[model samples]
Target: NLAALMRIKRRELLLILLVASQFGCIALGLVWGASWLHKWLAQSFELRALAEAHATTQQVAVRLTRDGTKNFEPGTAGWERLQSLCERTTVPYDGHLWALRRDTGALICHPNLHEDPSLLRYSLGRLPIVSSGRAPTLLEAINDAEANDEEIASGTIIVDGALQLASAVSLPGTNTVLLILQPYAHIAQAATDFIAPLEQIGWIFSFGVVGATTVLTVVLINRYEDTLAQSNAELERKVQRRTQSLLSTRNAVIFALAKLAESRDKDTGEHLGRIRSYVTILAGELARSHKEITHQYVAELAIASSLHDVGKVGIPDSVLLKPSRLTAAERRAMQLHTQLGAECLASIQKQLGDDDFLELAREIAYSHHEHWDGSGYPCGLQGRQIPLPARIVALADVYDALTSARPYKRPMSHAAAREWIASRYGSQFDPEVVEAFIGREAEFRRISEARFGSAASECDDSESTADSPANEEAIAAIAAGI
Candidate 1:
């Protein structure tokens, strides 16, 4: 009982209290900010959908009514019957229809109003056939002319406590204004029904991220528990707790971010981790040789390296994962990934409030493909003009990619990858990173030999990652294997 009590008791309360104390301000800020953000995004989405629906529905209505009237030949008996039939259909069909008379500017029909007949007359009286309102009127939305006819447009409105989207237009040379209101209940049911399932998916995703964060927080906290334990102030303990919470949030956020890139490409989170390792090794080698680079710079290179392919998200799969080499046009399109990656970094940075992380990420994303000699795109920065992290990751990313086989290409050996890096040292890659590779030849050899192995040089286009050394061990066990 005592054991159970201890397990259930004071520590959790203290932890909660401590977390609330340290991160209360931040936690409150985060939650409040998230709530506002969700609402803003939803409203914006709803508005856009509403606007599109309005335009489409109006255009379609105008085209149909105008064309239908012109096609009605007055000499034929079929024309009268067709006109009558068209008139009948104009009334709201189960709240999805409105019939306008072509000969007279009159509201001719509505759903279920046909039976009473008297009620239709009253509706026609109150309903203005045309309005002087400054806002877009039905006429503007559903424009039907002889040569250029637009389609009937649909829009959302609330009528008699019911929500509906109406589509209406008129025929050319006719006074009739055709209108239809798709009831809000049906539209909402159709629109919102899919969201519940999606929300569930989102909920599971959110929880999964939270769960992963919890594990990471526990690991991080446990590793620094001794240090955390040394903190004397209740507030400091709270701050530490909050720090862990925020840190956990950060990890979750990063994982979610990686997932975004991963969703576009089948080889996601693993791909990011693999590239990060390559970036780290290459950066470590570079830092030792280049006085311009610092150890912190190397670490930043590793962290930001996960985002090198982040631009791939903006690239369509048809272009990105093509089995064969891209055409000049397609290749140019693919090159846009660098810019897209920068945009993504900028968006996240904007959201994250501009920090060193985002700053480094943006730099790496934009300039990683830049050449040492200004031949690389998007911008042709030469020599030290490129950011160190970008230059460092550029070499690392390509090296790992060459050694790691893909669907379309075979793996190159570490030696072969090195040669490739060497070949392009000044043209494709930073000369400094290349010199660093040569000067710290032993470290380079060790990192290569240890990570890829001595036989990696034997790997060719036929090689597969299934047995490659480019695949890295998990961070937790990197020490064990190394």
Candidate 2:
């Protein structure tokens, strides 16, 4: 089933099939060719054996003729001497050399008579005859040899339970024939030895072809897999680049919307930018001490902090633009801006699904004004009840307001603003967030000065307030105004 599920292209599959077919054909060819070669070698070896036996018989006939016994009478001493000469001749390759009485098919003598004395007792006619399917009998073989002008006649026979190749040759000038018998098993073994090197060569060729094919196939598959891996890596990189581009565009849109809300108060110059930088710095520093403050959290917090004042867009222009401190009802109306901004962002988040940026913005907008002691605003959320992003933005918001020029007051110096924030720790802000702000106060001041010019080092007398409910409301109003 896994093989069935594998996705091989038609071209690749076809190439594999073709290669396998070629290997099969090559293997079959090697087997068939080896068989043919073996048969050829066997036939050639048999022919050479027969020719050597015939030559040995001819040499014996020549030796007898040189002894002046070629035309000797049958029962004469010279004839007996010629028979003794034939019996004394040494045969090569364990062959049997003997003579036969041609006219009556009687045996004369043999070189191996001592090993097989029965051969001297029978004439060719009396010897046991054996046939191998369409082959001639010994008598018929002798007749064939005589008819063929006394040329050597070769045939195979079973003698004493062993197969033998018998070659018969007529004597040159006598009524006698020379026969040489070699064991068929011995000739067969010689033929096998003769072709052993050739068989080895065939095996090596077969193995080489198969091994080369396997190596080539493996190399090709490896190359194909490497190419596929590179393609997947390239595709992943392209997707990441496109995703980053889309996120950049979305962030640009979010910032533009936040800036639109900030535009309601002309005095809020670069307020959103300063808040982003401050929240980023505070969250970055807090990340070192808190596992929850991750790089992603810090980045989202920076973008979300800009929307802390987005709710002010819902306030009436009269109350929002008032140069003096607001009445209780006017301040209450302005406070509803927090809920308005949160609701607006929540609706957008529902349409966009659960986006991290929009979710953080909604939380910061609704809860940044909430206090650490449950006394700060629309909801009396205490301590950690306030979202981390909201608590972080709370300190950043108050610090920026104290240091920037507002419609109701001149800018306070960096030292005065720092003192004001330090005094409110644990009551107006999360202690950890306050600590992070204090530790990185210099970076915060740098960001503030970079956006709005450095504030004069003088504190205004009217900006200082006593710790009372009336003064707290005024301070809360000023902190939320930005």
Q: How do all models score by TM-score?
A: 0.44, 0.48
Give the per-residue lDDT of model 1 (tens digit) for 27-65: 555566555655565445455444554554455456556
Evaluate residue 29 in candidate 2 and report its C-alpha lDDT on the 0 to 100 scale: 87
Query: lDDT of each model, Cα atoms only?
Result: 0.58, 0.76
Best by TM-score: 2
Model 2 bad stretches (over 4 Å) = 1-239, 450-455, 458-476, 479-482
Q: How does candidate 2 fare on TM-score?
A: 0.48
Question: What shift in Å separates residue 3 of candidate 2 from its native position after superposition?
Answer: 11
C-alpha positional error of residue 399 in candidate 2 after TM-score superposition, expressed in Å:
0.6
* Pairs that clash in candidate 2: 107-123
CA shift of 24, model 1, Å: 33
- Model 1 misplacement above 4 A: 1-241, 266-270, 289-297, 439-482
